[model samples]
Target: MSFALYLAIMMTGDQIELVQESFAHVLPAAAGAAHTFYDRLFTLAPETRALFRGDIDDQGRKLFLTLAAVVDALDQLEKVVPVARALAIRHVGYGVEERHYSIVGVALIETLRGALGVRFNPETEAAWTSAYAILSGVMMSAANETASVKHVVAA
Candidate 1:
């Protein structure tokens, strides 16, 4: 959501190596992020909890693992556009909203800050903000496309 933060990452010259490094550093925080996000979601909209199956503990782990794996893949995606498009179609079933993404981004950043400790400087924050923007854009585009196609992916 921060334009300046996005600009910094956009201008940064680092390529695949930089993205891979960031993803590596993020693995430890991913699981905690899933917990935090679900906590907040349940707190804010308890009804949303009904959307999930009874077995949610494993769902939590799967959520984080999928995010970490998907992000790592994004860095090396020979065709990120198609992947995002497919994911968008899949996400339609969940009734995912653009606003929920902001919540996830918040928990994600907080988790990274926790894991990174003192290493989470302004530059790191900027990098994350930019990365989220790109990631969120993918979700948004996918949502729109899914709506048009009447396709859906389970959450």
Candidate 2:
């Protein structure tokens, strides 16, 4: 399926509320959540480990901060799209591939489940799934566009 199709399937208002509310609970333990997320990501896609050259803790913190910002701007996604696009382009430079987004999404859902425990119900999971789908769709689309430009220039 095309990224545009993924983009068309947006989260419902209730789903957005669920994600934001659950994420609020995550903020207090953001450091630990970040660590768990990386652990899950690395375990699921060990090859992804090679992409990070910096301290894991530092990278985790940065990832958490970015997630926080994205969650905060969920209702106004336009505000986040430019940032997400630039980040996606940068990830392309860092050897990130399209498949990695699903890996990260799986890791994210698992991390949230671990962090939220009993609170991470099916509804909440569905909400996050929807949110990630849209966000990753936007990112992958941006990355593809960047790659296309690069290919054209090279050709």
Candidate 3:
């Protein structure tokens, strides 16, 4: 199914609204949260750290921007999913594995909780979880399909 359609089926409008609102509130702290997310990701999966060799500050900013874009585009995910898939394809060159997505999600949630403080309530957390799952699932599926095509081309 299309990522947008799948997400509509999997998530309620309330869930999407909660996540978007919570993320907007947390936007000011996005840079710090992004940094925290990367730090936690490195701590959780050290092997993935080497994939980043450039300036971390820029990378963090980019991550936050990308995340914000995704959150903002939840209602029009068809437009965003292609960009996410492109990102997945790029990450393949950076040696990103499928397992890293889950670790990144965990780190992202922890970062949001830390940054948002008491604002990250149960309902908000659930919404964020659903959003992350849908986004990550789309990225991973696209990455896998791209890899398969690459492998076939190589063979």
Q: Model 3: per-residue lDDT, tens digit, 1-155?
A: 75578776777889889989889887887777778888899999999889998999999989988988998888888877888989999999899999999999999899989888898999989999998998899999989998999999999
Model 3, residue 148: C-alpha shift (Å): 0.5
Model 1, stretches more than 4 Å misplaced?
1-19, 26-30, 41-48, 74-78, 151-155
| Clashing pairs for predicted structure model 1, backbone only | 90-153, 93-153
Per-residue alpha-carbon lDDT of candidate 1 for residues 1-155, written as tens digits (9 for 90 to 100): 44334433452545434445665776666666567767766776676687676467677787666666655654444344456556656666766666767766776677667667776766777767666766677677778866766545543
Q: What TM-score would every model get versus the actual structure?
A: 0.69, 0.93, 0.95
Q: Per-residue error at 128 for model 3, in Å?
A: 0.5
- Identify the runs in model 2 with alpha carbons over 4 angstroms from their true place: 1-9
Error of model 3, residue 50, in angstroms: 0.5
lDDT of each: 0.63, 0.89, 0.89
Q: What ordering of candidates by lDDT runs from best to worst? A: 2, 3, 1
